[model samples]
Target: MPQRERKLRGHFSTPPLLVEQVLDACGYTPDKDLSGIRVLDPACGSGNFLAAASRRLLSYGKQVGLSARTLARYTHHNIWGFDPDPIACMLAELQMHATFNSCYPRSQALHRLHIHQADGLAFPWQQCKHVDLFLANPPYLAAKNNDLSGYRSTHLRGQVDSYLLFLNMALQVVRPGGWIGLVLPDPVLARSNATQERQRLLAETTIHHIWHLADVFAAYVGAVVIIAQKTPPHTHHQINWRRERWIDAVPAQAADKVSLPLQMVTTVSQDLLSQQPGAELRYLLSTIKGTIIERLQRQLHMQGNSQTPRTLACLGEYVLIRRGEELGKESALLKSSAPQPNELKWYPVLRGGIDIHPYAIPTASCWIAREQIVKPLDRYLAPKILLVKSAGRLQATLDTQGHVVLQTLYMLQLSANPTSQPETQALFSAEDELYFLMALLNSRILQDYLYALHTAYKWVQPQIEQHVLAQLPVPAQAAYTEKEQIIDRAKLLMHACSKSSSVVELKAQSYELYEEQERAICALYEIALQQRRVPDPPHDVVDEGVSLYG
Candidate 1:
């Protein structure tokens, strides 16, 4: 995107303090030889990176007894910048000119500093092959309108983000052992579309460090700055990750003083990240959190047939997941504003993210004809689970009352095949199974799994995708007593939810029971319970029989 467009849209430009931090994090400073660095910002808009290089060169010159005029020539020779926007290109060149003239204290405009108004993605191969450090904040645009035929990720017909092409470009541009620093939207770290690029990154570079901008880029625009060496990751190489956010400046102090907030750091082995399923990297988890996660996913031998008897039963095998569709012809679909008037067989539609709460459904003000829906009507009419897709966590309810559901939710239909596991078939009827599955999906334990594993992806909208919901771990409650207990609790909550009389007391009772139900499901999954100390008769309040969890 052009800098002009970004300013018009109210998005942030690179802060000077942030530029300094990014430089330090990537080992780019006056401590290194600026003349030999050959820094390049492929997506430079107003040349923030080029200016950083200029500052470093001037600082280096001061230590070595060289004048600002001498260093201005060095800045003119070494830094390179490119942008597709001609207006942006002129501004970037002006930015470089301003940097050089700052110490000279001149009003003259400088020209011809190796900066070009061309697509960096299509920069000359000869020049790019010699770049030492590729540093830039590329556009967060999609590849929808561009001709990506020349890029590697798009060469094989793979659709990718525009920033991904910049990453691919960096690998070819930066020399071996050279560094690449990029400020990217957070999805680049964990999205499925970027899975191949991440795997390639581990195979081709030693990802040295990351800075998670904890909502400084807006909560919806979660972003991170990644620094890596072009060299392949070696065994025992660890990745440094830190959490940093923005803070408001005090009225008494300079604004720059509070621009960089306090940071929390963690280190994880590069091998561990490579080992993670699909190479999906996230903020490093602590030991206690890691241990708890391990237990949640640990394979347990439940009562079943001998084939893969020791494995934790897969959730994907039990149900067919269907994503709801968008209803654009609302005027045609609308029959009445009343809730399921039914006089003309019109059903109320749930089209909002907040339409369904845990174990409950709110009254719908919009009614629609079933025949007007574009998707297969049976999926919405069948006994299924309604999971809100656009939530930070899983919000689900079992829907036996056939409602016209829209794209904001996912409709889960329990697959009842005869060839399925005998225990699943014998233990559950079609509707009973929906309740059991609903209980699991709505549990606090699985909600924790969703966040730690996938759905809480900190970029864009964290909507629950169909594939992610299909992979949620569901314990095979082989014990008849346990299965019945979950279903009974879910039923009690649902029963309490449908009534209109004594709303206050019933809602309170339902929530209290819901929490207890979450606890029971947690126990079923062997999730660790917090330990407490009980006073011994005449002794100190010391450690008692605590849990065996880490």
Candidate 2:
């Protein structure tokens, strides 16, 4: 395929091994008669899947004692495929013919190949409703870029992806109780934009398994293989969600040499998935971690005296969270005019997340011209917390002078109407509250929770959303003694961090003080101390459970 055409159509060829895996998942084997089984690959690129399926069906026919002519007839009649690219359709037909000829030399069934040069998305469903298995590696183009107006339906809404539309099409064309195996982008399960389509899919089909195949493509596009069965409406069943490293679906050597461990797997109830709007898919977590997180939530709720456990209030209730303003053409703004004499009016512009650290802003690296400033200038005049929006670890610091933060940071200030509720007012009281909240935000527990919730893949940067921050658990009301002790420790740590001459020394001191403060806070919330421990040094070297000398 031409590079430009491939890019435009999202044409990534399916690996033969992955094709075999999908076939196995659908219970297709070479030892049984598959004459009645009708398989359709909607976006059959070069007929990779059809070619494989034809070989499997031929093997089955041989095992069932079918003659060469009967096997050839079955291959030509049982399998169908469609692709928009004429070249792809031609290649698919050739592949199927070659596979059948290898199995049955006397049979002349090349002309009966069902591969068609038709757009799968727009194919007439009424003509192909007898499909028993809808298997495909659909195009990955985003809906906005691809004109899917012809495939649009009530279930398909918002900025949909072309692959998602193909999934809906497959559901419609597959007969009741038939199977569907599709290679899809991993985000189809959790992205905010795909929530509606995901809901519809869950409501209509029984998803048997979801195999997350990370970095499976040569292009390194994160992909997943979803195997589901079309069923009557209102059907519900537990979905088996599994995760693994790049699937070595094809063994490089002997089968015994391969060690493909199941990284994680869990059965998820439909009711559980429906409870959250995003269908957040907590099954992705290991069973043990999931249980621990649930227990932690329950423990926090029981802290309150009310019969109904108190849920953690979102951070938005007590604080105004906003992304820093983007002052376009920074070079022009800085060079166009000089600042006035008043230092208060001439605020320093934060360069990026690197300039901010826990409880401290490293230096006044750059200055913004006051006249060129945009709206929310008042935000730059008050004390607020600056959060690094794109860091591996969450980095936040207090900006007492209200510096002009760049777009890379988020500004968090006490809400103007904090007095609207007693809880809000209590949480935002001056110096102590901010210090305590900052301590909790940077704690070990919250850090672990954030990683579980936000980190999708190791290569992807983790982000903090306003809604996620709001749900962070904090003490509903801190006692005066606890508040004073926390504020005092936080202040000391801030002072130590600012005065340190070496970054290494600063980090060591900060971590020590943070641990002390974390213990106190965790105690107040009745949370057990589960801080990760450094491994102890080995006393002696052991070889096969025996000391070297022994």
Candidate 3:
């Protein structure tokens, strides 16, 4: 956006301290070279970063024993800004002039600061090559007013975000190894779906520091200021987990310390190519020829139907249904009182879907058993039947407490336990069935797939149908053992992460564990998806038996 347009629209300029903190994180030194250092603030609202840069240069010049006139001349020539708001550009120029006059009231040869009213997204940046630092927070508005479709078309396919596109423009204007910093939302850090864009940035840049300012940027919650060095695109490399948040780096000794509440911050970067080898297993598993359930059926046939077989019903037979909309209370109780003799008991219910709040299992529902109960299915007897909530904002795993029917926010699937009691009937399990199912549901790949599907029908009401849920690919029996192992490992990591004192350290360790296991799972799933055969786990590590307290 142009300076004039920004001003016309009254977009608030970033506070000066925010700019200073960002620059400091980028390793700015007051005594560094000031001459020929071109700085561009793409969304230079009122030129806050630009003005700060000028001041820093002046301080730097003074520290280096330069004359006032020399400092004034350097500031004018080095500092520059661009915004779509012409009025903003004019105000910025005024700010720049004022800053210069403070340095050299009598100097006549000071170069005027370059401020322009140009749409940065479409601007010709090639002329500004050799830019040293790209600074400023870009506008956060969606590309299209109605939906993110425009954003998908214009930015995502280019393997870039709006800010990233601006970064690309800046990179075009900068010399190799130049620095870039911007304030962005958390989605960019760990959101798994934007593979290509993440690949492009990771391939071409080095993220030096991330200032997680979730508290300070509360209006723009979950914000982080990313500091990166621009490098030429090259072969992928192993990504690192850096846990130090921007907030931690700030000190009491700095001239100005802007503190934000500690929010969870974690960073991970891995060689995209290197992951392929580990993911080979998942790939193989995903490509397998037949449905996992079907494969299990075949295995059952091979076993000569050793156990009693039962068909899954239309779902009405085993359970009753209650929609979230039916509840008049703010939140429903899982244990409602017995209203009549031989009435069904209510039990806890869980919904099925991604939840924004992690670890939030749905506890809001009133479930009841049928008045005249039919014999429980063979499948529901062991490991407890899950009252999987199919609708609402979250998806979860449910446990048996009583004769409860699932809410609309559920998936009526069954999970098995390997350790069956003497009274327990053979529920049928290839191996590690529970962990395998969890792995399929929790994989980043599956999350992305589901998210994309959700986005496609965003115009429609938020309703995920049984057909849609059924269509999701399930890995076959061959990979079930491997899938189980992966999920077990992931569960351990998650448990470990929850106990750590530092969000950064915990997430770092968590992701490392996640990456290792996820790749293996992905490779296995991939193989299954392709209808190819999969190898068994190299060893029988089974469950790690990591116990979680609280």
Candidate 4:
């Protein structure tokens, strides 16, 4: 199929190992009797799942002493597959036919096949028998107004996707207390916009296992295997979360037949996830430090002698944080950094990337004409903070040079906190206030808090949006004298960072200065860094069995 057409149809094939792994998770192994288990694949594109399941059914059917005729009849009614592509449906039917024939020869009965070429999203599922298990790798596509004509679904709400609709359909089709094993993208775990889907999943079903397979589909997305049961809410439900990684002694040159290497990292109570924001399933959050980070984020600092505890003042109330203007097609109107004769006036553009670092702005390497420059022109000229949107740590610098920053950087213009008590905030001058805030933004505590709240995967690109940064907390629990000391030190540190220094000496000096302010900041918020204890292996784990350490 053409790439565009394939994308429109959302046809990403599941690997053979992945197909068998999903089946094993669903209890469709050869050793188990899958006689009464009616398995289904809604969007069965080449019948990878249907064929594998059929083979398992035949293996267990004969082991339980069933004749070929009875097994064929049972397969006709139990194994089901559906697809919108006719060619794909034919391929699935052929695979299933061959699977049944390979187990029981001369049993190629055409009437026993139930695979259909139809859109699973709009299929008439009520006419079919009860589905005991739903096993599928559904298509993933973001839902837009023009994406599907007259497409309306209950699951389609704020910022929805096509995969969510398919998952919801499976929940409704499968019988109560049935099993649902699916290969889906990892965004369902912590996407802020997907709160409703996460809530519905937790409210309705009991999640047994979630395998985070990062980068499993390089061309597609980071995938996850969710093994859940269609059962109502119950107390004391625990989810075994695992991570996929290469084994220690395994060589990278190994053959392709080796399935995903699995490691049971940790297991946590469902209640804990349900209580968090977006109820995110951050599988790596298995320590006291993670808990402490959560507490620090929710801590309410005192303000103006108010007896009732309240949230600290946010950065948004005092700063205008906006993304850098896009260059668009106006790049053709620019000039060199040295300034061309008689050309439009050129101003240095703060090109984003590895240039702008903590307390050090990149020297302008390129210039753009004022006509090409976005207005209000003073927005770029003002002494502002240029913060680059990065993953591992915070990167920001004071832009005193009035350089126009390009896209991928956020310009933070500081203003006095409107809600602050005059007696409390009047201690610092305007310049001092800017420096103090800059120090905090580039501080270690804020970085850790942001990562803990958003992700555990440092390598993964995070959603560090303007609104999220605007919500950065500012604790105002200090006397005027203490605030002055902090502001003075922050100014000196930023000034020190602005000068040239060797990489080694700069790192050492910056760490020492940052630690000083970090201590003050932590003291202000009453937070301390909690260490992550190393886990010891349990002795009770059997051979090849995953250990449980919750």
Per-model C-alpha lDDT, please?
0.67, 0.66, 0.48, 0.68
Lowest summed lDDT across 10 adjacent residues in model 3 is found at 541-550
Could you tell which candidate, 2 or 3, scores higher by lDDT?
2
Q: For candidate 3, lDDT tens digit of each residue in 269-374?
A: 2332213312110111122223333342233233333453222111222222232322322233333543455553433322223221122222333343433223
RMSD, one per candidate, in order: 6.8, 9.1, 13.2, 6.5
Q: How many clashes (backbone N, Cα, C below 3 Å) per candidate?
A: 0, 2, 67, 0
Candidates sorted on TM-score, descending? 1, 4, 2, 3
lDDT of 2 by residue, 1-550 (tens): 6767676779988877777778877877776668889998989989988988888888888887888777777777889898888989989988888888887776665558788888877756756568898899988887668776766463445677787777778767888888889988766766777676677667667777777766576443567788888873332356777766665555522322333344676765554555554655444433422244444544443433246434344456667787776753255554334455665556677755557777664565577767767857888778777777765466666777667877778788777675224243354356556676677666666666566555452223445666666556555545567767887887777666752232213565577776788788776555231321112214431111111111
Task: Please give me the total number of clashing residue pairs in predicted model 3.
Answer: 67
My TM-score estimates for the predictions, one after another, are 0.84, 0.77, 0.51, 0.81
Q: How much is 238 displaced in model 3, in angstroms?
A: 8.1
List candidate 4 stretches off by more than 4 Å.
1-9, 101-112, 124-129, 154-156, 243-260, 277-279, 282-291, 300-311, 327-338, 341-344, 390-393, 421-424, 455-460, 479-511, 527-550
Top model by TM-score, which number?
1
lDDT of 1 by residue, 187-240 (tens): 877777788778888889999887767555432566678899888887767688
Model 1 TM-score relative to the real fold? 0.84
**Candidates 1 and 3, the one with greater lDDT:** 1
**Error at 12, model 3, angstroms:** 6.8
- Candidate 3 has a TM-score of 0.51
Worst 10 contiguous positions by lDDT, candidate 1 = 541-550
